[model samples]
Target: MNQDTTMHPRDLLRQMFLAAVEAAQPARGVPPYLPPAPKGRLVVVGAGKASAAMAQAVEKNWPGPLEGLVVTRYGYAVPCAHVEIVEAAHPLPDAAGLAAAERILERVSGLTADDTVLCLISGGGSALLPLPLPGVTLGDKQAVNRALLKSGATISEINCVRRHLSAIKGGRLAAACYPAKVLTLLISDVPGDNPCDIASGPTVADPTTCADALAIVRRYEIELPQSLREILESGRGESIKPEDPRLAACTTRIIATPRMALEAAAEVAAKAGVTPYILGDAIEGEARDVGKVMAGIALHVVQHGQPFATPCVLLSGGETSVTVRGNGRGGRNVEFLLSLGVVLDGAPRIHAMAGDTDGVDGLEEVAGALLAPDTLARAWAKGIKPMDALQNNDGHGFFGALNDAVITGPTLTNVNDFRAIVILDPARD
Candidate 1:
């Protein structure tokens, strides 16, 4: 078949990435999974990059009186009539998140069996709901978060630690609504789409225990404050278990997942007259390492056409990590793209884009970066060494220098990361 060259390679690549993000949007995912209006009272509480939008979706469909509160990352708020939308820091907890967590717990307390709580959950919720347990201060929570993020601990590992030290997560939020039924709506950002892993499973039963959290913290060499360590050692940080009766009235529905987002991007590729191949939606690893593996795959496809043919797109969605050894600003997507660009070494017809679906990659406002055959050549001409950039973990700085950072400020949703490699054509003489 023939390659579709009507749209520029860079634009087509970005279009696919945006298509993935649009698929996991709260407006589209929240409506279908909304629970029916309850009998006694309907309470909504949530935390995430997408929580505000999810809350708005709930308000638009519910036909009864419902008052709620949801905290999202700063600037991610969506207005609602009854449900209060609060904004807070993300990827790290702040006093604002601490206050919001307290309010959410208080809001769900004293509910009878007739009352229903609609828990809106998504990625970023873990940090957005930072209610430290008695002996664990908010400062302790913030310190641990910083160490875990820099240590390159996986989201699941980091959340396991967070849950044990929190008074609200690990089914505690749902427990607070004792006798009241909770219908949780989640837009899963974790690999495997595990409800318990999403937002550290605030309203769901957690089979993991305090020992598990301690193990992860130790394995990652995360420096926890003495208070946090004592909580783990004393078992004071034990999470709500799976057989806990408080969770009997709770249920969850994952409205959107990385796989769904990737599928949507694949559909866009097909419509664009290109074959779309989804490698895996739940891939996990160091960002640069994953990029190198993808580069090997792409090389095989380009040179031998073994796994997939030319003129096709390889699509994937999942969260990759960065172990910060360099002084560069954070963003796993840019790191992955930079590594891919390095490995590809200016190969012909290989173009790719990687970005966080939520529009913020790491601590930076840039989503990610785009890479082309001439990326390295351009960087070298500008006296920027791609190798040095990679070593410094400065993917954002590197791409920014090349004027290639993809910025889609505040897409108001989170479904982890989206990556697409477009092998537009064969090598030319």
Candidate 2:
């Protein structure tokens, strides 16, 4: 569905987010990338928030029989008759994930050249398929993951560490399917849509090494378990290199990405008669900093119209990081909106929305939050200081107080964050 000009600006913003999400749905993105059925048995195995949905899509479209297992974050699973959907913890590994990883490895092992292994990957797979190397336990991996998340390391850095520590990631999963042709269908959730960064490149070859992972851990000052540190220093948990012959037959395809989602949202805005200008789809860095920069861009667009004229919508996608320094609920999207509001200070004739396509921002069930020109004025009316809220990293509380937080439960798919700022012509308003 397209945006409706008659709809409220907030409603239009939400419709744009939903349209972006719909474009990344597994059913919509998977079919065109599906390959010809293999002559031998088809074994499907995957791990991520979207893997279960992707598997279901595969089953619905496949002409032949398929058997497999996929693990997804809790509450993100969809029913699939042939493929078993195992729900597990996300952003962190659990016992279930470890067991599923073992089973998945076993499922693809000993495959013949005639057999085909289909690996459906997406965001969160790194945590959903954590199999630690020998001498390391799941708790150790969990500790590292927790530290990395809180350390404000980019997803690439975080996944680099994960790839080294994981037994299934970093092309090891593809190596296990050694003589078999492994086809990996990915829903890209990382900036630049790098195949190796998505789910830590379980099925694709990894060019990083143990030393690189160690450098990232050191750079972030992430305290790793002594044994884990030893493993890294000793080069024991090194990932499969790009020259590995076992990965020669493996093919990776990105079927969905943040750019695709942003483009879809742009189409909705265009349909509603709003010119959509995509800033960039690979934006990164601190959430608050990005918000401030976006505010400047919006102001420039509204005043000078050099970048674009008013009555236009600015669109961007990509994951932003939040370095939490307070004891408040932290969500990158909400934090971004809050910081943007602080800069706007009730600017005239502008509205914006920021949300994660996965439907959850940070640890909260809220997707993100909305921003109106008078956002700060309304917050002041409620005795809520936007600057203080931003400092506390309490975007959830700030937006919740105004009843402006966007909540969408679990979207069952992830393509990173979506942001849109609509600038209305003051004269028209």
Q: Each model's RMSD to truth, in Å?
A: 1.2, 1.8
Residue-wise lDDT of candidate 1 within 13-124, one digit each (tens)? 8888888888888889888887777779999999999999999988888778999899999989978999999999988899999999999999998999999999999999
Task: List, residue by residue over 1-429, the lDDT tens digit for candidate 2.
Answer: 123356667887998999999999999988998879888989999988899999999999999999999999999999999999999998778999999999999999889999999999999899999899999999999999989888889999999999988899999999999999999999999999999999999988888889999999999888888999998899998888889999899998899999999999999888888889999999999999999999999998777886887688999989899888887798899999999989988888789999999988988888999999888999999999889999998999999999999988888899999999988876645
Q: After superposition, how far is residue 373 of candidate 2 from its true place, in Å?
A: 1.2
lDDT for position 249 in model 2? 92
Poorest 10 consecutive residues by lDDT, candidate 2: 1-10
List clashing residue pairs in candidate 2. none
TM-score, structure 2 vs. true = 0.97
Indicate which candidate wins on lDDT: 2
**CA displacement after TM-score superposition, residue 220 of candidate 2 (Å):** 1.5
Q: Count the backbone clashes (under 3 Å) in each candidate.
A: 0, 0
Error of 2 at 90 (Å): 1.0
The 10 consecutive residues of candidate 1 with the worst lDDT sum are: 1-10
- Deviating ranges (above 4 Å) for candidate 2: 1-5
> For model 1, what is the C-alpha lDDT against the true structure?
0.90
Leading candidate by TM-score: 1
CA-lDDT, candidates in order: 0.90, 0.91
